[model samples]
Target: MSSTETVRAGSGRAGKRRTPGRAGRAHDTREAILDAAERLFAERGVGEVSNRQIGQAAGQANNFAVGYHFGTKADLVRAIVRRHTAVTEELRVRMLARIAEPGDLRAWISCLVRPATRQLDALGVPSWRARCLAQFDTVPALRRIVVEESVATPSMGRVLEGMFRLLPGLPQEVREERGDMSRLLVVHTLAERERALHAGERAGTGWEATAAGLVDALAGLWPAPVTTRPLPG
Candidate 1:
């Protein structure tokens, strides 16, 4: 090869080596920002937290660090949801694959609840994710972000599909109502347990036990017969 060609080849190899290091640093910065944002948002509602505060909490001296990395607060919330959803999705997908009976209500419900509880368990004590999600559930805009990013995933879609298949006889309106109920139940339950753990309070049981309790409660809730009220004459 010519001298010029050899030098160009060496430069190309060096660029390839440097690319990943740069990318890794950027990824680490983004993750740090996400961790700080999740904690702050959980403790103080999303509206009360600012980008500059998040930047400082993440150890970024640059005032624009959060904005540069994550754009708006809504975008940052979406990023945090996406970060955890990937892990929960994988867990749910694995559980889905092992489901033997399509009509088993508890099995389908397990797909919905266990993955999230399991993720929290994996996060260990003093986790902020469940509380972060609970906060998101309260804000209309942030809740929408959570629904779009996490709820709309393929694995979650499949979980809902399997769940609906088991409840074919349920009224459409009731099914929708129960769907909202299930979300509330799971979110609040996990958030409460997370808060307890964070405060050094006894959570009463481990995550597996919590998941089992939630599954049992949902199994009952999902299949309960709808009662009709007579209209006033």
Candidate 2:
């Protein structure tokens, strides 16, 4: 039944049950659409996948179901990103509370990396969320949504503040440059591992190990000497 449909024919007990049943089914349908869209968007680029295709993959008889639930392509993408970011945000918040040493670069870097890896780990194998986000990050508009939802959060602000406090001498240009590099490294690296795990190929290590390596690299990266400064633009 569609979300708009009402079970008016039933009485009392049956009516109460059917009302909740309809809502339950609608919630299930929305999740089904999200999962289908994530996989399709990951396997095929966001521009390549149509709403009709996502609806079909989600087993929706109505071709317009995607629009009905998500409104537009950007809305759909934002929803997908929120699905993951919300979980990661919670993870980061807890990790933040555990920070005994605000000066520990590794601690703060782990705050940045481990939440994502832990979320991916909880998602199990054959997942496409990480790869879907990687694809989205390549598009400027979609990348903004990704960053707005994931990076521009209160917990993330604290993480960046904690991390940067240790590197007071780093040049602004290099800081911004390395910031971009860190994002790319974490995103693409996890996406690659997710791709490999989904493809039954060698992923080398689990999410925890991957996160540890990323944390180690980023720990070194933040403090590395800036040799050449960019010419004034």
* Candidate closest to the true structure, highest TM-score: 2
Give Cα-based local distance difference scores for all models.
Answer: 0.84, 0.87
List the candidate 1 regions with Cα displacement exceeding 4 Å: 1-21, 229-233
Residue 48 of model 2 has an lDDT of 93
Task: Locate the minimum summed-lDDT window of 10 residues in model 2.
Answer: 6-15
Model 2 misplaced stretches (Cα beyond 4 Å): 1-21, 230-233
lDDT of 2 by residue, 143-208 (tens): 999999999999999999998999999978888999999999999999999988888787666889
* lDDT string, candidate 1, 44-90, tens digits: 98889998898889877767777777766777888899897888888
Clashing pairs in model 1, backbone N/Cα/C closer than 3 A: none
Model 2, global lDDT = 0.87
